[model samples]
Target: MDSLEQTMADAQARLEAAVADRHAAMHSPVVGTPDGDMRVMVLRAVGQGLAGLRFHTDARSPKVATVALHGRASVLAYDPVARVQLRLSGPARIERDGPVADAAWDAAAPFSRRCYLAEHGPGAPLPAPGSALPADLLARRPSLAETEAGRAAFAVLLVEPETLDWLRLDAQGGQRARFVRLGDVWSGGWVAP
Candidate 1:
């Protein structure tokens, strides 16, 4: 492969490492709130392929509202141990109560599904701390079919990245590059680190 392709592949590998890092977060850098503030979200790597990365969130959450208002956003994945960081910019599409969301919800972990089972919406004012799920449901893992009840509150944010930029800082030196999508083409080049 050419140098540019190799750089992009290396970047993707670093991003995958970050995503697979259980100790640290698989995070997105910013989501523009309607008021134009930035929100950082620790997202689960629900899916990553030709469709780009997908993250699951609550339909009533602020992030969903934010994405609805401003589809443009960026995701930053960093692996401290690997000394690699990847920044991806894209347009986010939020899907709820649809086929896309259905599949995502169904694929979610049982404990994760419990988040949607809360009686109140996310960030709701609770009389006390915690998600405030029913006492019974809290003790056990809900079945996949049981999770269906929470489907209405589940949402999937699919981000189609137009640009994927990366930086690798090491003891020896630092390397930076970016792959930008212009129309139907995807071209990449190095940058000063």
Candidate 2:
């Protein structure tokens, strides 16, 4: 709050906290692809200096293909109680097989992994509204071995932020800052809210 550096640090802290704290307001941020599609995704991980953000997804999801083709993404998160918002965009990629994806999949709970066990990808049409999970899985969580079938459909979406717009609202007015990354370094300054 006293300096630009502090503001940037606050952004980093909020992002990192969002990943670890499920109840955090920013825990589920809106992820957008170049195809103009957006959805709320759980925040899985945040890298140092806001370098890379990790999210889990189903490889068969439409966003996976869009991200693979465009190699770009945007994420927006807001904390109503804190009156802060973070808008970030940059290069991104979907990895179905890699250390990152593997680790993410391994870290997921059985219930979480059950999502990828669906016979079809997200948004699949059905006769009636349903989760698309196997009939048995609908009633109970899958065991570790049962989740193996979902591994092939699991993926990690990694977003390396190149720009971050951080804003905070207050009674006095508001404060805003924009940061751009160049290689490993980041340069930023205050901006009008």
Candidate 3:
């Protein structure tokens, strides 16, 4: 592969690793606010799709509504160890029900699925401060069959990228590149960091 191709591949690998690291807080969706600001939230991504990243969220989530209204979104992931920052911008879609959503729900861990089983939507006010689950389910993880109840609230968020800015902050020097799809080929080159 050529230099730009190599750079993009290397960056993609680093981004995938950073995103797969559950301990890292690097994988969050940043949605545009009405005032043109950005709101970032901790979200668990299912994986990367052909065009960009895919993640899971509650159908009742404010983020879901935000994506619906704006259609555009961004995801920023930084790996301190790799000294790499991946900034992905794109149009996002919320899949509430379909083969893809079903597969995602089925693949989720019971603990992760527990969030969907809650009695109230995210950000709902509680009469008293607590775990936010149905009172009866507060003590234990939901059973597999019980997970079915959460499916209705589960959704898949797909981000189709228009651009990916890859920045490497190495001690030797800093290099940045922006990747964009043009026809069947990838196009980008080193730019100012």
Candidate 4:
């Protein structure tokens, strides 16, 4: 292959490796939660672009309304292998019952849709134990028609990352880097560890 092709392949590999490393780090047990707890599933990354890290929640969820009102949120992703942690801050917006919501709904499995159909709201009270599904719904699992009713309840949270602080720990020394977006441009630089 040509030199340019080799260089492009290497760059693509590096970008994929970075994303995979970040994803693995986020699944680590030592990750921190917004409530100051250490939890593995603290954050859910959603959305569709490099600038977007999306999360899905019920429209009635407090966090849903919070981000809707505030338009900002944060996420922490840690990589155990590289001993790196990424702290991301961004502006958030809610997309409900639109193309984005429809797309997200279509991507969900029927079982997940059933949960939404069963719940009234994000933190609504649950049915008594042993409660049974309606006979018709029981004879057959929830169909696409049954799940459609819950589509309005789902909300897509779009977060446009504004800044990312990458911190790494190493034996010789530590490393820190910060990336900030300004208009259409993204600029980054190393900082003191």
**Candidate 4: which stretches are off by over 4 Å?**
1-23, 27-49, 125-141
The local distance difference test score of each candidate is: 0.71, 0.93, 0.73, 0.59
Candidate 1 local lDDT, 34-80, one digit each (tens):
45666666554533332356677778887788788888667776666
- Candidates, ranked, TM-score: 2, 3, 1, 4
lDDT of 2 by residue, 1-193 (tens): 8887898799899999999899999999999999999999998999888988999999988999999999999999999999999999999999999788888888889999999999989877988887889888899989999999999999999999999999999998999999999998888999999
Task: Write out the backbone clash pairs for model 2.
Answer: none
State the lDDT of candidate 3 residue by residue for 1-193, as single tens digits. 2477777777566546545776664655454433365666554443333264677888997878888888877777666676777777777888998887888888888888998988888788888877678877777888888888899999988877677788878766888888886643668777888
Clashing residue pairs for model 3:
none
User: Model 4, poorest ten-residue lDDT window?
Assistant: 1-10
Judging by lDDT against the true structure, name the best candidate.
2
Poorest 10 consecutive residues by lDDT, candidate 1: 42-51
Highest-scoring model, TM-score: 2
Candidate with better lDDT, 1 vs 4: 1
- Judged by whole-model lDDT over C-alpha atoms, candidate 1 comes out at 0.71
How many clashing residue pairs, candidate 3? 0
Relative to the true structure, candidate 3 has a C-alpha RMSD (angstroms) of 2.9
Give per-residue CA lDDT, model 4, range 97-134, as digits (tens). 77777887888778666656644564556656532334
lDDT of 3: 0.73
Q: Is candidate 2 or candidate 4 better by lDDT?
A: 2
TM-score of each: 0.82, 0.98, 0.84, 0.69
